[model samples]
Target: MKPAAFEYHAPATAGEAVELLAEWGDEAKAIAGGQSLMPMMLLRLTVFDHLVDLRRLHELRGIRQREQAVWIGAGTTHSAVGRSDLIRQSAPLLARATPLIGHAQIRNRGTLGGSIAHADAAAEYPAVALTLDAEFELLSPRGTRTVAAADFFTGMWATALEPDELLTGITVPEWHGRRGFAIEEFARRSGDFAMAGATVAVGLDADSRIDRCAIGLFGLGPGPERAHHIEREVLGSHVREVSAEEVGRAATARLTSVPADLHGSANYRKRLGAVLVARAWQRAVEEATDD
Candidate 1:
């Protein structure tokens, strides 16, 4: 199907994009890469009176290491994230997960900000961001504001971004200690949205005890869900001492609230969540231990 006719405006800078959004109000939709929005628009699932193109916003593109964080511009593509040596060194978990997003072609055209802004429950980035505790920078005509990943995603296909706000960049803290990270996702095919997935980041103390850990899972709730209970349980326990089955059980129990969908039953999804978390946790432990 063809999309409805709309006025198109290409902005050279983020401020210009903000001004365009402010002028068009809710009628305007900012597009970068157009991986998600274009399909929805073509199907008439979503319509916009004005299309604000952000391809020229060079300010919103790059990867850099600041004092204690890695800053990734919103315009950076998934392929870039997957291939970046800086990201591989500073944010290994993200690097590991980026390649798993669709395939090479999708990765080439899909933007990091687009995926996060889309906030699809089945997306890999949202769960990864939540695990990394990444920060999102949102720009608007009024001003700029930063939101933690936990607060940025409000619900399925929903976020805290105002209609006039454009996500400018993402900030991920550097992991300094002995760390291991892993992403485990189950999809019918290589490029399909995951049925259930887990992104785990684990850091070990000198004694090999789990000092810090994050478990972010998706495909089980309105949006990506954090496995807080599992984290609490794993902390202080040695990876060798922790029972993945027990952790899996605990994970399954906490997901009672996730609704059933056509792809999976609520119970089935809960089981998959448990399995993913256990596998991701085990692998992360191994990686961190080897480091």
Candidate 2:
């Protein structure tokens, strides 16, 4: 099957793209990279009367360091992100997670913003964004605004972005001190989507006490989720005294909406999620302690 006939508009600037979106309303879809959207369109899973191509918007395609955070343009491809030394240094979790997003071909054309906006619960980028407390920049005719990662993802394939808005960039705050980040996922094969996964970031005080921790889970719920209860449970505890297995259990215990599908049952995913969390926690803690 082929996508429905649609008028294609390649806009040179983001303002023009959003203007087209505003004019077409729900009938227009802004495309970047087209890794995800093209497939959906090809399958006829989604249809748009107008396709707003953002490939020519050069402003949305760079990686830069701000005063305290790393700002990545929305159009930056996964391949570019994976190869960025700046990203590896300032936002290691995002860098490490890049290779896990499908194969090289997909990463070559898949944009970071496209993945985040698509909001697949099983994708690595969304979970990493949530774990790092990244902020998203949105542009519309009304003006630009920022939304925190936690508040941006609303539901399955849904986000806080309005119809007329365009995601221009993402800001990931850099963590200082004895900090460690790790991402673990259980995929059946190297390029397969994860059945369950977790991204962990830990910050330890000089005395090796857990000062702060963020655990983000994916492929276990309707959208990427933060393990707030588990985070609170481990704070202030000495790293040696914290049990990775117990933390994993606590992380999955509070999840009320783990998804069940052909791959696994809800209970099975929760179990896998627990194991991934434990693995990720242990790796993050080891790195933090080694520092």
- Cα error of candidate 1 at position 126, Å: 0.9
Candidate 2 lDDT tens digits, 18-65? 999999999999999999899999999999999999889999999999
After the best TM-score superposition of candidate 1, give how far the Cα of residue 239 lies from its true spot, in angstroms: 2.5
Model 2 RMSD in Å is: 0.7
lDDT per residue (tens digit) for residues 249-273 in model 1: 6766867567677878888888888
RMSD, one per candidate, in order:
1.2, 0.7
State TM-scores per candidate: 0.97, 0.99
- Weakest 10 consecutive residues of candidate 2 by summed lDDT: 254-263
Colliding pairs, model 1: none
Indicate the TM-score of model 1. Answer: 0.97
